[model samples]
Target: MASTTQTKSNSGVEKHADINWDELGFDLVPADYMYVTKCGKEENFTNGNIIPYANIAISPFAGILNYGQGLLESLKAYRRDDGRVLLFRPEQNAQRMQIGAERLCMPSPSIEHFVEAVKQTVLANKHWVPPPGKGSLYVRPLLIGSGPVLSLVTAPEISFLIHACPVGNYHKGPINLLVEDKTHRATPGGTGDIKTITNYSPVYKAIAQAKARGFSDVLFLDAVTKKYIEEVSSCNIFIVKGNVISTPAICGTILPGITRKSIIEIALGFGYQVEERVIPLKDLFDVDEVFCTGTAVVVSPVASITYGDKRVEYKTGAETVSKKLYDMLTGIQTGRIEDKMGWTVEID
Candidate 1:
């Protein structure tokens, strides 16, 4: 195995004490069980497992290792007030993984299969799902090539599996991002558009450099112009000016975040102007507000953004518009508000 990690548990099943979401920085809680499946030869997928959310098992010959062929998806399971668990628009994640699989010449899992896998996990481990506002289970679905081959060409054998963790938000404090104009996350015409493991290697240096310089994360710029803001290390960036909300348009280079789409639609539904257009890093300095969206942090504020030596700051909390959106989004997720869009699917 590349890195043998033992689960911090007994019987290989995680038996966590009722988690303290507030102390964990989690506004939500994690569910207990997880669903998984595997792909074998002959375009066949054998029955997977419904394992407890504790440890992971993988083969040393898993295609993700020697050749770097894999994709992953992340989503949350919200626990509603009526003692029900719901999932957001998980179809998008499945569709995205299908796209990634096709591009890598691997087999794709059926949407039905994907959704059922998720449902099984949430239903079995419903107790792990923290309260609506505390935190929720972080579901991760992984697809990797598993054929026993050492060739250089694309292989037909692959495996699709799912795992979960009771992670709180990535961080609770305000986020400070270092803008690395010279360090690019993904090159144009590269696998930047796909959620492949290979896309992460080139940005390790930029991440390390930013951490050493007192920044919590790195913001990548365009490889060519270096003026347009692409994305933060783990999330998509946003700009708010007065009543208008603007985000970087999708150009097949950055991760198409489900949370980003939800926030944009929510803004529009609130009668605010929302624009998905090309945004420059310079525009953020003059904007009324700045935020980042992802499955982890949901609606995290940008306290300060730093370029080579220049820095800009912002203010946001429960009173600001940023906080309003955060509350509304999380409220809808946790069942505080009515889910008019039918974005949530009850798991229990």
Candidate 2:
């Protein structure tokens, strides 16, 4: 068994799991506990349990197993230098999950219930949170159609679950992207704007191809136009040109990322013009910098993008917009800077 050590935290004396903080990465280092709740179709979630983390069994014909009726959200808990744990805009994540649950036909948890459950899970696994600046504890909440239903319909039962893991940066440094002309991520009026589980796996092949070709991820275009940039495989995309910042609008195709929304606000606060519109592919060649935003990557500067025979490189380093935003965002997240926006929830 791995050793454990006691530490004085905001949640009182807690036993921390023995692990190497310096070698943390964006992989699952399973925390000790998880949160789970259940509801019938059209019912509201009320009661939940904090259980030890382990494998779960489900029916073979369950809705999530057969018809892809599931939604998920990702948020992080940061350990401050003062031993306090903070969660960044978890209410936004709760709202997003509620929206996605409606689309996926699963019973949604109330925002209060959802946020409370997340807090319980994080506190239960408080020992897993890395030290300040070492990494963070990644909290993932999932809503799934747990009841068995062979027909193509909503399951009779729904489950809301939350789990956590300690992780580092999703991307180590500046990343290169391959613009995928084919295999669109979502169509008009689809579940792209939400965090549905079905929205992810279809792009695995494209991302795999990009990784095989020495690229970090694949950048997809709008399904309807095929010429306008939509998003990276897992995050939202943005470009900087002159004094304006442009990103694809959340027009039922791109996920409205929490980090992306936060960055837009920060940019406007810094006196930069921000535009949410359809960004054309050719515009990448003229941009000064490019970056992606999501819960995992946070803010990642794009080193270059390859489309067909042409490759366009963008600006990266300390002087770029992404770096400045990253510093401010992380500073607020880790308590290095004051959270003037009141975006963080202090876990006691």
Candidate 3:
């Protein structure tokens, strides 16, 4: 638990909310404000406004509701000991959302527009940022087709909004995975690489089944061949053998994770040979370490993986590559270590 502080809001009102930062989980704890903007089919994104957090009104025939035409991004704001807030590679998320919007035939906010909206949202909810090393304010940016449409067609209007919540680790500890063979998350010619809401909802059943069997998450295989390792349900997978680290290549079937890309560069800086190729399920049995990386999970070690009736376990208590990477990444995030990579953006 961290001490409560009374902070003034944008409206000049003092807010004194007691928050248990250390006990925060990956749940949505509504903040004080959110940023919202909208655009028509031929118009660029307009200036956004910071509004009180509340439910939004939309038409029932909106493309987002009728056809699931939307994209979302997840990033975080970290509170440093010096009372500075930092955003971890927000431009990357902006670019990814642009790509997702293009894939869904929807217009997207420019990188500058997107980043500015996020900054405004975080600033409005600055008091909700957890204490340094305790947790972070999880920022979610969403773009949806807001125009009402009856036939299957591109949306005529779109809206973008940014909201945040204080969150801890998505998974509690080292997690166990179940290899999925029946349910496919994505395919070669599908919207797998994009962060669309439609891409996520279809996998709910598979994940529910995996959790029902007492596993932490589901590890998906390639949809077509079903022989190569693709990724976990929500994160990218990597395995370390000896001094080498390998992960599945981003070939339209895997979402390019910002944390995954950072870890690869960090590992290379540490003189570890990094390989991006097709990893087979059999390779996991011989790997010394396994882990998953994403915005929500950060870096989580995989304790064991069960494929069918056979289960393979790895070492994951303390001294491991995953732990080392997690420490380095979190250190850079919280300003405890020098950010030589220039990945963090400081917010005023």
Candidate 4:
């Protein structure tokens, strides 16, 4: 790996030392450049530009610091065998961020501007994209209220920025989940469906406690009923039974994951019956297989789940539905398989 001091010019690509792709974890390995743009109350987004990856100065009393007026999106850039870079469903992420901004009363980039900024950032740091079959360059786009404010109100100015990092799996190996009976991830009339910054920090304590108890992740239930499964702390959950696959419905309580949507479409294409409905906590005990989907952890198999006194375990490893979905999804992403769904956008 190269030192962080290694930089790239906007007009030319710089080749850094080879990274140990297989050994890559989900840590942030900084790239050479980032995209930044800003907007005010009276103006749309200005033409963005690429700059060296560094921190920005913000006011101590910024609205993002006080009112939690921020949103984020996560997508990945993949390297194919032929040395081309591909982005998977970035438009979906852009659209989701737009909706999140609307809900949070923050300004966001348009879909075209968001996609272009992502592409520019990826291209500027194309050398950081991992090799095929190894990992990907994780792209994170953030929108925050940068202007200072004392009272509880939306900031007049907003900042949109993007950064890329070479990364691997978010959760390693088969995972064990702890069902959270106490903490609630989202309520019915709250900011549950959006990727707002405030929605994540509230669940840190629950996730930390679960990890301390030797669980891989915490599973959250609905705030009102507590009997129906909503989602995991960071990803969406699904269960398989024979030829049928089902996941909890996106009923304004769970974040609509891009990978979850892709998996549902791909499963339906394979003639598997797919259903999106409320999944009672009791249903997990009788499921044949269980898994999770997200941007960071593409697909992860669930080995066991602990809910109160009842502990349910499932079979994981090769030849499972999760394995198939992972293979198909990654294949399409890396260009090993035909992309019939038009989900991938290749960079020139």
Candidate 5:
């Protein structure tokens, strides 16, 4: 944890939040401000600005409240050792938000607008960004249909906002996952590939049950075939067998995670044959290692996965491939190592 002494940032702002940095977790610890913008259903989003973080008023008939029309994107800003702040591939998040927006029948900010809003929001709450290695400032961008409507049509207005909070590891360490065979996360031609608000909460029942059984999360198989593995409730899954790395292909079923994409490129650069194809659940028992990737989980190794009466354990520790990937990824993200790929954008 960083010293609690008062300090100034490069932007002449407080260097840290008053809360105990050592106690940071994935939970929200509201920061000082957020970014917000609104647009009519017909107009494109033109601009947004920083605003004090607080509860947003929405009508009871708002589409987000009534029809669950919303999309969310997550990214993080890291305070480097030298006190510089960096964001990893925020444009990817922007592109993804546009994809989700189109699918949900809503207008989205362009990539430039999205990136600028994120930069402003992060710099505005620079103090909420934890000290080097302590944690990161988790930025959440939400695009919602905030307009009131009584019918089943798209709302008259849309909202795009970004909020952030300092966070520690989403999962404390290596996680245990339960294979949900009965309940499915998404069906064919559904909203699985996007980060829409509706794609999450339905799985809460399965996750709640898994947690009660002492598992960290739940993994869902493909809804149609129920044979191939899809992804976890939140992150994308990967399996390592010998020199090959494989993950479920994004066939409009699995969320195309930014971290998952970067990890694949990194693995290929390391001379590993990476595959995006159907991964049978049975392969879990034959794999040498298993790990998951996401904005929140990063690259968490799978300690154990339970399917039916069977359970398979994977390699975990500092010597694992996941650890190496995590190190390289975080190194590039935090400026501890040269970001040869130019994936990070520094906040001035």
Candidate 6:
């Protein structure tokens, strides 16, 4: 908490001393500090520190010198109305990063280290935290193969770093998406369940095509039958029918988003039947509503969906449930709602 002493200016706008129970939007200039650490082929994680954020020198044979061995996680920090700094379920991001690290045959940062590093980074930039309601800061935790070697095979040298930016909604409002039955986001026994870099580049071609056609995102289907839904490039998909909520099961091909899980729990609490099973694209045209969940989108409604030659429209283009869920989430995040799940962690 910032000191409770409040400062008053001549115009009558008061400044918070230590505790800021209020939050306002900020214009983010990247914080001046960051945390970095490295690990060897056989080692676990190494100790590191926060330093001035700037340029770095790298060897010609860095592990990421190749193309596929890297991973990242994204989340946010808020400066609430009273000037309190908070992180929403940062431990989930840290745990997901640990899983992603291991998927690439790299070292995993202990959850404690990951959370501590995030707190340290946020504390280092407390002054830069925009006020509440202005888009919050986007925190990105990245891991890359830093081992110095020139080869196509995976060897040791892995590294971790944390960076943040003041950010807003990824997509401002209801978005149009295309059903992708052609390409695969991840293969069986692949890194689909993890948030690794190698897993996402495969969709660039599909994503490019969709954007070219004016679609905001791609709705990927199952790799096998090419019938059921998977997820968007950066989010998990959900469809609501009256009182029921449906999403694709985590059958090893989806990112198993943290937001997805939280929404499911919230929906259940609201007396809705949340089902996790195979969700076919056919359901979209017939469902009551549909939307997406992610660290970025949180919950963005789907007004309409377009494929090559067909479009699926819903009566209630704006989903009542998704909007409610989003409100519940942001409410908890901004300290206006209860934290029943213990997701929010106060930074200061």
Q: Write down the TM-score of every candidate.
A: 0.88, 0.98, 0.96, 0.95, 0.97, 0.89
Once fitted onto the true fold, the runs of candidate 5 whose alpha carbons sit more than 4 angstroms away are 1-5, 8-13
Ten residues in a row with the worst lDDT in model 5?
1-10
lDDT of each: 0.76, 0.91, 0.89, 0.89, 0.92, 0.78
**lDDT (tens digit, per residue) of candidate 2 on 126-171:** 8898999999999999999999998999999898999999999999
| Global Cα lDDT for candidate 3 | 0.89
Better candidate by TM-score, 4 or 5 = 5
What lDDT tens digits, residue by residue, belong to model 4 across residues 153-244?
78888999999899988888999999998999899989889998888999999999999999999999998888999899889999999999
Stretches off by above 4 angstroms in model 4 are 1-14
Tens-digit lDDT track of model 3 for 1-348: 223467654335444347877688987788878999899966789888999899999999999999998998999999887767899999999999999988888888999989888989988888888767788999999999988999998678899999888999899999999999999889999988999887788889999999999999999999888898999988999999999999999999999999999999888888889999999989988999999999999999999999999999998978898899988998888888899999998887
> Per-residue lDDT tens digits of candidate 1, residues 1-348?
011222233123333345555665543333445566666534755556787555556567656777888888888887675557788888878888888888887877877778778777766665565555667777878888765457765545677767665556786678899988887777778777777877777788888988898888888898888889989877888888889988888887778888898998888888889988888888978987789999988899888898767888887766666788888888888778888988887764
User: Whose lDDT is higher: candidate 2's or candidate 4's?
Assistant: 2
Considering lDDT, which of the candidate structures 1 and 4 is the better prediction for this target? 4
lDDT of 5 by residue, 1-348 (tens): 223346776556465677878888888787889999999999999888899898999999999999999999999999988788999999999999999998999999999999999999999888888988889999999999999999998899999999998999999989999999888998889999999989899999999999999999999999988998999999999999888999999899899999999999999988889999999988898998999999999899999999988999899998888898889899889999899999999987
Per-candidate clashes come to: 17, 0, 0, 0, 0, 24
Task: Point to the candidate with the largest TM-score.
Answer: 2
The window of 10 residues in a row where model 4 has the poorest summed lDDT is 4-13
The residue-level lDDT of candidate 2 at 2 comes to 39
Candidate 3 lDDT trough over 10 residues, lowest sum:
8-17
Positional deviation of residue 345's Cα in model 3 after best superposition, in angstroms = 0.6
lDDT of 5 at 266: 92
Question: How many angstroms is residue 21 displaced in model 5 relative to the true structure, after the best TM-score fit?
Answer: 0.9
Higher-ranked by lDDT: 4 or 6: 4
Q: Which portions of model 6 show Cα errors greater than 4 Å? A: 1-29, 315-319
